[model samples]
Target: MEPDTLFVVGLALGVLSIPAVVSSVSRGERPRIATITLMIAGTMLVWAISNKPGGYSIEAIPAMVKRVLQGFT
Candidate 1:
């Protein structure tokens, strides 16, 4: 798999976990699952960033995601 793909997956997972964290906090419960998901997302993001030659630029993110998504079809 591509680093850009991993980056996208990590970002998506991190975004998805936000609601879970908020819900858990609102209910006075620990964000155990959300915390785990965040950890995984962080790891993937780190790995993807580190493995890339020149790293990533904010401007290239949209193109990267588009390429990754297009590869699936």
Candidate 2:
């Protein structure tokens, strides 16, 4: 699987589990379906809006005076 897909899937599953665990601790709910659902939805929302930009760019650096002097005849 692609890294992005893996990330989204993992995020969804992880978000889903948070609420389930929370409810289990408080009201003794076996499954916090509502909270988990909401969290998962939120994760998807963010992922949809934000994606990795393609390609890469390199930045040029200034030549140091020391290096320039060393190369002088």
Winning candidate number (lDDT): 1
Candidate 1 residues 1-73, lDDT tens each? 6788899999999999999999999999999999999999999999999999999999998999888889889
| Backbone clash count for every predicted candidate, in the order shown | 0, 0
Query: In model 2, which residue pairs have backbone atoms overlapping below 3 Å?
Result: none
Displacement of residue 47 (Cα, Å) in model 1 is 0.3
- Model 2 agreement with the true structure over 14-56: per-residue lDDT tens digits: 6667766787778866665766666676665456335534411
Q: Which ten residues in a row have the lowest lDDT in candidate 1?
A: 63-72
Off by over 4 Å in 2: 28-73
By TM-score, the best candidate is 1
Show where candidate 1 strays beyond 4 Å.
none
Q: Estimate each model's TM-score.
A: 0.94, 0.37
